[model samples]
Target: MEKPAELQAANYDLVARDTKSVGAYVKSGAPYVWVTAAAISVAFIITVALLLLTAARGLPHFWPADLVQATYKEPGKEQQHLLAEIRSSEEVTTARLLNAGLPVDEKQPLYDRLLLKIANRDLGGVDFRYVLSDWLVERSQPKDATVLERMEWGNFHGFVVALKEGDKVVASGEEAWKGYQERQDRVNDLRGKVRDIEKGKIGAVNYDLERLRLQQRRLELDGKTPERNAADFAAIEAKRKSENEKYEVLRTELDQLNAEMGRDALVMKTVDGQEVTLPLSKLIQGYRPNDMGLFPKIGFFLGAIWHFVSEEPREANTEGGIFPAIFGTVMMVMIMSVIVTPFGILAALYLREYAKQGPLTQAIRIAVNNLAGVPSIVFGMFGLGFFVYFVGANIDKALYQEGLPSPTFGTPGILWASLTLALLTLPVVIVATEEGLARIPRSIREASLALGATKAETLWKVVLPMASPAMMTGLILAIARAAGEVAPLMLVGVVKLAPSLPLDGNVPFVHFERKFMHLGFHIYDVGFQSPNVEAARPLVYATAFLLVLVILLLNLSAIRIRNKLRERYKALEH
Candidate 1:
């Protein structure tokens, strides 16, 4: 009966329109291709838009904006003279405005409020203030207003009342401004010298002294008592005494510089008539933005940007540049790439060139591909358990027993962080390298075999050189992934504030056992954990921008290497 029905349908010799349409769509594959392309286009557009927004928000933080002088009259209080920078403005519902005790008109649906950076932190007790739009009776960028970037108390916004040398007023009016600028430069120079003497020379001596202590401990351990290593102890003692003398000289000079710097102070008057006397040593910079010429403004912008890039972070990392974070991130990523490449390439070679074509080999390949999909946090946990607690702790016990109470390698550090990242990105490298090797024709191997080349030699010379572009591809992917990873790094090595960089003049020079700051972690700390949310807001955008830039630069470098290798082996690839 079924045969009869099939025969009857065949006899009709008519194609169903829906069936034909479905067949045509499957054959062409246009729908799937278009959908994928559309998705990719949308993703690209979103990434570009986000980057633009970050740049708009972050890059302007370094620009020296003119200070605004506004008289804001509160309902119950008298007129408050506000000398601050109008950082930003946003519209909020009238309901929210009223909730904040502002007299918002009930008829108005929304009120525009200004974000003012009231930088007299010592007096105002806050770096930022939000003022009602309606309360502003006067708003002007006063010509004489000055903004002082400080070493402490965040920043100061006021008029230059006078320049004081101790109890006497050395300069006032126009002369005071000029004198303050000149004196500020001298103080900055003195601070630089102090920093050098303390962190460079004195720091090196301290490091050496610690090493000597370790040496003494090691000597004691080698024997049983101090008397057994008496000569070694005497030599170490002499070295320590010499180092201490050098340190004392630096300390005396530092004291002299500090005394000289503290002699001059700036007498600044706020718009409210409250005067703040800041020592020239505490002031990083002073600028009258409202009166700056175009060239001067450009100079100030450039200087500010440079300072952000070169200077150490301060004020809970909500202010100042992220130099240490930048350095650490780049160093960690570079180290990870170095460690992963050889290991990944070797594992890929063993599987591709020598392994038997069996179920086990196939299973291994599957496992590697699956590893790429594993959650990164899982890798972080694995790293903590295996690399740090197991391997690093053992290393510390074996080599640094003298530094025991404070675990050196046992603690989270740059080396462990890099290694953990290497493990996380290994699957990517293995998969890329395997694919590269698979693409190499069997005839190429045969040709090498025909030439009487050993299998190892042939693989190294022919397979590896040809596969280098793919290796670079894998490395680029690894860097892109690792550079932006805050979770794993936070677990492994990253910190909010690294007192010293991993690289310093300490013993072994590259102190990979030190905890370091990272750009991604810095962004996280500022955006979420910072106490001053308003002050930290712009910096969060800025740090995110920098992180993206670092990733882009790393990718570009790898791409450049890949392109070069591809060109060199183009004929072989063909």
Candidate 2:
């Protein structure tokens, strides 16, 4: 074979020529690099486009749009004057409009139509109307046009005809608007007082009364006759009487506030020429949108967004805010994190550091991976059967014998829902933590051992601290998955509406036994199950955006923690 150096040079040249061939380049994954980059770019673009679309559709809903006053005349129907907001515009084929019996030009291929929010739903029996743009005449925004945000009915659009105290007219015309504002402020103050009495004092008294009842029932179940426990019974009765007196006082105050609020009325004349007498109690707010300036509209828009995130849902979950769902979602995720972290860490430690390395260990790892892929609803069913029906039933039977029929812990509630999610996300945490444990250098363990440290001490002080970042990574992933899980929450605990939150001012305040609302389920309920499809559509997008934001916040927190841990332990890795 010639000299060894010459032979190696010949082989290198042959290899270089082979690698330069198209087949070799393809086999080396050189072409795949561009393909992979293109795929990633496409995915990123799609994600950005989706977020922009969601923001476009959802963010504009809060803006106070100008009210349009127009005269609409159809081919065979009477001409009608309309006071409404143009909700949207669409282009429709001329032939389609003709088929729908709308008069349109045959020569034109397409005609524009305006979707108007005719908000006097009570009178029109519908909230929206679609009319050909060509049929609308004399379109203008009237300066005196008023829009009422009402507690009942969707909305009311009209002119402020008069303001009255009971049946007597107090003000009319321009004076009516000022008088109406004063009366509305008074009503708002009264409403605040009424809510304070009802939700604060009345709620507390109710809690006390219920607790006393439960105590008496428990004593009865303990075979302690009223005669034998006369003092205990008397104490409960005395407490009940005290709470009842408080309730009566609050109730009376609430009634007085209601009467005062109802005394004032607004006489509004609609575009249809019918005058409606609306009680001040029914009106949330009234604004002349057409008269609003840019700054005023911006303020109104911000106020609307705040209300959406702060108030509770109303009108079949279509018309109001969704604070309850947001609260419940956050609370459930927090509880699940608290429960899953320790269990996941312990299980991962056993698998990676303590368990015998064998076929059994390999099989167990395979099983944990498979568990992560199981449908989340299956975990819900398991939680229902094992946690609720079995464990919760036992707890209720043992501790809450007096409330046996009511089934406190035995029902689907926040606790069961959290447990279900914890189980669902457990596999992710185990895998992540195991990978973290595997990454720790063996020399670090040996060094600790040589320094006369026990295995447990070394693991506790050195290994776990370094692996903490991975644990946080797993938690971030878990939170992302848990916050958006609607199917399992539906089976476990989430409801259409929760009258009271799980955590409130009641005694033993954190009530895990209470069923609660969730944002994912709220989105589903409003988007697909509401009676008013058009009204609920924007809310669906809004709720979805809120849910995404919540997940992002939770993940960001976890990621920040993970980054800190990584930085703290970066030197140890060397």
**Most accurate candidate by lDDT:** 2
**Candidate 2 lDDT, 24-112, residue by residue in tens:** 88988978999999999999999778777777788788888899999998778899999989989999998898898776779999988
Model 2's number of clashes is 0
Measured on C-alpha atoms, candidate 1 has an lDDT of 0.89
Q: Which residue ranges in model 1 land beyond 4 Å of their true spot?
A: 1-37
Clash number for model 1? 0
Q: State the weakest 10-residue window (summed lDDT) of model 2.
A: 50-59
lDDT of each: 0.89, 0.91
lDDT of prediction 2:
0.91
- Give the distance in Å from residue 395's predicted Cα in candidate 2 to where it truly belongs: 1.2
Cα RMSD for candidates in order? 5.9, 3.5
